[model samples]
Target chain A: MKEHVHHLKDEEVNILLNDLLEQYGYDFTDYSFASVKRRLQRVYINDRFPSFAEFRYRVIRDSTYLTYLMEQITVNVTEMFRDPAFFQALRKQVLPVLATYPFIRIWHAGCSTGEEVYSMAILLQEMNLLHKSVIYATDINESVLEKARKGIFPLAYMQQYSQNYLQSGGQHDFSRYYAANYEYAKFSESLSEKIIFAAHNLVTDRSFNEFQLIICRNVLIYFNKDLQDKVLHLFSESLEQLGFLALGAKETLRFTTVAPLFKPLAQKEKIWRKIAT
Target chain B: MTVSLPRTLVIGGSAGSLDVLLQLLPSLDPACRLAIIIVLHRKSDNETLLSDLLATRSVLPVKEAEEKDLLRPGMVYVAPADYHLLIEPDGTLTLDYSEKVHYSRPSIDVTFSAAAEVFKERLACLLLSGANTDGADGLQMVQAMGGVTAVQDPGEAEVAFMPRHAMTVMQVDRVLKQKEMAEWVMSL
Candidate 1:
């Protein structure tokens, strides 16, 4: 048994990060150091490692241990129609523009657990565009992507999610989308079929396809400015002309250097359309 | 040049905290070099409104904390709604959308503990009037990290449960009325 250390020193954290990159080929150096360090500290304390040195030693030796650490570092907090107003704006404003295209391609970048992606699908279904749309739901973690593909969310959240759906201008009963089975509500297969779930790391992966709409909400906030700029650039290049991009309510295009490239469709919702090539 | 301040001042409150904040902001010295970070338990939509309100009252610039935003002295940063604002080791702000802790997204404890770790002895955290106990553990963290800790006197606070709860949990450095709190901030 080993005693727990309260926190890791900066150098210890750096060494562990470098070790992770060299051993696993996963680069997290560009992620926000504060968040990366905090998550690493939790991994150390929770696993009851005596010291960061030992923690790093175990992570470097066992691939399984490293995988567990990766899960901890990726923040997966999401909800169905998390901010209903954003979705309402999307339903009223963005979806209509998206309808003008014969085919719609939406990339849910970092689609943790797929709630938002499902929400998008539901909105599209209500708008009579689900059959014509293809949603690419990609996350860096396979475990979460698997969860997203299953489309099972806890029953406890259904009541709240239903409320969110109604507020977001849901055209039908939200309960119509899922079946209750004990503690989990399994969403309909028809909704899940329109989505393609894959493992893609925004940090290392390149754009796989062009999209009319790209949603990377609550994901960029975890990255440092350099990484945010890089990922935003990736999103920009991946979007076609006049494409729509939606970010988390707290996120802003105003802070980034690429601000001039996009024009706002809904400012409060962080919805923008690419105006520059 | 801004004189190097020894510590950053962090203020956290909820519910009735806004009135006290409204009073405190106007009195703060515009040239003060200590960075001020405010976290009020607020509705997610009111974040920009709060920043705008505070900016008009204070002489210093006020802005919502952005991802990886650099911290500068003589400016005020408010935690953006729906995200946990953290002080990174490199003295920048990082936002996290992780599930809310203590039933609050910008949980006072989360921000305080992170700031305590980063600034250590060069930190001062003040727990203000609020209806909940969000700031209690955070003030303890600040104190444990050899930083200064204070609470608004329960008598003067519009809603005192927050500061009163903090008073019982730890040996705080000061329990001052809102006016004295403002004076202390001015002196700092």
Candidate 2:
């Protein structure tokens, strides 16, 4: 039966998700079914579930499997300074305006694994803006949030991340930001102090604070058009007039309802500035 | 058995596939109903260049697949360099920044597996030239899902590792030369 899950119908998937939503409070019906189904297939195959029906039964009956499903659904593929050019553009184009504000609030929505949040903190520290800034990094997964709070990453990844830092215009040695132990590198305590890691579901949560810059890279691509529009609306509401919005390289506002409300500040980098109403 | 025509055509390739693509893309039927998706290994910084180059090959309106773009018939969608292109259940194209599989973003396996799940038997996938075994497992998945599967003949491929690997691992439906592959796609 597990071998046949690749042919699972959208109706079947909807039934499973709807049941999960009814039993648990988590909702995923709004996500694009193709991507969600792809993730679900991985979970089913990896955990050796007999069928989608069995998987759904476990999802409704057991809390641990539900948590595992949530982790799978959220794409946590992130790296420190994943795109150096985007960070370079952020420093050169977005930071100057953010510098003028007495106190800045930046929301890192869907900040999976906290790599980019730490990247931003390092950037702020270099620019001497760390004291005046507060970053609220949020994701729906609590386990990942716990990992983010710990501020430790695999030591093997540090070499590549250091190169990304240099390309992104680092002012000093990238090694200075972390203390490398045996297999993991624990980021400086000061860098971790400025970031508040929490669970914030983009699907259900309301905007908590008006931010000067909202960095939600790569997360919106996982959502459907309606969800993308809803999340964009939330960002618009949560941002100050003329606040900046940054997205992943492939993500754009071209097809969304909120495209008209923001002007491109850096088009290729997918940065936009809110237009004052 | 009469072959049920596919609604989508996916082309997966890697290091050596570009040249074969340049050779094959121009011959695609402009009126074909299949939505063509191309997943090739490429650098993230080489944005728009691949699409621009492929655009010159055909009248099929070649462009990088954008997030949430509806899959239109006769249009050629190349996976954007850095993001995995997925087919949503509604037949719309969605881009993902998920972790790289087989050390490559926009992985052929990721896209092919997702497209196979969505399109099922209504999908046809072709494995082209490359140096790695990336698309072999994906084509196997496609075949397992009862979709049509083809591979570029190893002898004809510039670098045969990709197609050769597929041939060794999976029972693909066709092992055609570049020109024959073009003709086959046009016939579809």
* Top-scoring candidate (TM-score): 2
Tens-digit lDDT string for candidate 2 (A1-277): 2355545666777887888678877788888777777777677777886666787778888898777778887788899998898999989999888999999899999888999999999988888899999999999899889889999999999999999999998868889999999999999999988899999889899999999999998888888778899999999999999999999887889968999999999998889999964
Lowest summed lDDT across 10 adjacent residues in model 1 chain A is found at: A1-10
Clashing pairs in 2: none
RMSD of each: 2.8, 2.8
The TM-score obtained by chain A of candidate 1 when compared with the true chain A: 0.96
lDDT of model 1 at position A130:
96
Which model scores highest in DockQ?
2
For every model shown, what is its TM-score relative to the native structure?
Answer: 0.93, 0.94
Error of 1 at B157 (Å): 3.5
Candidates in order have lDDT scores of 0.86, 0.86
- What TM-score would you give candidate 1 relative to the actual structure? 0.93
- Give stretches of model 2 more than 4 Å off: A1-9, B1-6
| Model 2: docking quality category | medium
| Candidate 2 residue lDDT tens string, B106-151 | 8998888888877778888999888988887788778888889998
lDDT of 2 at A234: 97
